[model samples]
Target: MRLIAFGESFVAGVGDPDHLGWVGRALAGRRAVTLYNLGVRGATSTKLASLWRREAEARLSDEEPCRIVFSFGVNDTWHAAGEARVTPAQSLLNARAMLTEAASLCPVLLVGPPPIPDAGRQARIEALNENFKLLCARLQVPFIDVFRPLAADGLWVCEAAAWDGAHPGAAGYQRMADLIAAHPLWRAFTLAE
Candidate 1:
């Protein structure tokens, strides 16, 4: 099986000293799988949507089962000077188009963006996540909401807070790995054929 995961820093496993972000930990030890992590730091949905299909198509092998995982959104909520990098409406369009295209290719899973300590940015992230969840539901793609849970998790918050207030360390990544690993949809996706 080939799994192509697309996202930003969290998908890249940015602050983990171990270098194995949640993607590495969650999918570790799976057999007969080729995993590609296409996590570009500071990538927004527009950036990802523009490039993902071509990249993923090139990597997928017709001889094997394939899966796609999309986890991103936090970057779009970022502010520069005074403007949101990617507006909420633009984010929705990107999410719909990206998830729809990816789902057409294979079984797809959508993981919501994680939380940060900044109240303003966090609020944006939370709202984006809600919109993403609804979009995923409409598209029939499995969606995992990491924002609410991770926001309240002491370990996740402390690790991320003490660091860049965005990325977390190993233990925090491990918590995310656990959450993702335990999700029922994730199990079903991995278990399928």
Candidate 2:
């Protein structure tokens, strides 16, 4: 299996002390497969939509089972000049196009954006999460809602707040990895041979 994890800093494991981020922890001990972390700091869904194909194609193989995992939106929710980096509507459109193409290529899973310390930004992140959920449902893709759970988690909140107010520490990343590990969809996908 070859897995390509696409998104922004969160997917890149920015604030974690060990630097293994959630993606690394989640794939730990799974030496049978090749994993590529294509996450970029401060990247938006628009960037992901534009770059994922080229990135994934470089690592994908015909004899291997390919999979894609997407987690973004925190950057999209970021505001500049009084407007979001990527509007909710536009975010949905980008996700739709990306997921549609990714699904056609291989199995795909989406992890909704995690929460930030800012209430205003968190609100935008929440809205994006809801939209992502709906889009994933309509597309029949597996969607994991990480925002609500991590939003209320003390470790995630405190660690992220103490750090960059966005990315969390090792404990928080572990929590995220645990969540993904326990998700039924993730289990089903990994169980496939």
Cα lDDT computed for each candidate against the true fold: 0.91, 0.89
C-alpha lDDT of candidate 2 relative to the true structure: 0.89
Off by over 4 Å in 1: none
- Cα lDDT tens digits, model 1, 34-104, are 88999999999999999999999999878988999999999999999999999999999999999888888
TM-score of 1: 0.97
Number of clashes found in candidate 2: 0
Task: Write down the TM-score of every candidate.
Answer: 0.97, 0.97
The segments of candidate 2 whose C-alpha lies over 4 angstroms from its true place after superposition are: none
Error of 1 at 24 (Å): 0.4
The stretch of ten residues in a row with the least summed lDDT in candidate 2 is 184-193
